[model samples]
Target: MSGDSTESDVAQETTDDDGPKTHSTSFKIARALFGGVLAFTALDNFRKLDEMIAFADSEGAPAAERSVPAISGSLLFGGLGIAAWKLPRLAAGAVATFFVAITPVMHDFWSRDDDEEKEQHAIHFLKNAALLGGALAFLRVAQDD
Candidate 1:
């Protein structure tokens, strides 16, 4: 073979060396930090299935029991996939979908009558918006890759 490094050789060099590896390591940490929360929340949803369903029903979601579990499962798999860098696009899409679909419906601060309740829901809504932004960013990054 010529002296010119092969793609695998360059990849190996990056992995073996600290310069590029630091960036990679940081990205892995970022993925874990973002995805971990979703995974943990999903597990909590499963653990409190009845409460989740009741909350969904209270929000007037159709078929709360079924939808809750389905969404939770999507979040679980999506989060793990993101952290592991497996099926990244699909995972990011799933996470994005959850935030887009649930945020307005579930955390409708405008619908709340009590000031404190409205503020609480508003906080949740903003948090979900931030999460959705992250998911969309990952989705774009996955597409670029």
Candidate 2:
């Protein structure tokens, strides 16, 4: 405890024009957990490319064939970057962009006629909203750094 902490225990600190900021172990864990989830999900999407493309098309996504791969790639890159604290700004921005671009379009709960489907889509939309918040917070952290 007196010396440098291990990866899990390490707390990163950085200073900016305003003051100093500290990234706690909890923050790092949160980043890793969420980032890993996104990364894994992207890989899975890639594995089921045809299925994902079809889903995207069903969701009324334009140019689903091209956009699906591009989005998946960005997700993978952003997730890995954030988890590893590499290119943190770009990573966080990518995540934010992904959420902003997809949440309303893909999870259009308001457009659903079935109550159950609407509720499901609503939940997904809210979840993406929360994740977008996290991405913004991470972006701020990166900016401080």
Clashing pairs in 1: none
Candidate 1, residue 80: Cα displacement in angstroms equals 0.5
Error of 1 at 49 (Å): 0.3
Task: Give the per-residue Cα lDDT of candidate 1 at 7.
Answer: 72
TM-score of predicted model 1? 0.84
Q: Report the lDDT tens digits of candidate 2 across residue range 1-145.
A: 5797564432334543444443556667887997899899889999999999999999999899999999989989989888888999999899889889888889999999999999999999999999999889889888766
Residue 123 lDDT (model 1): 99
Judge candidate 2 at residue 118 and give its lDDT. 100
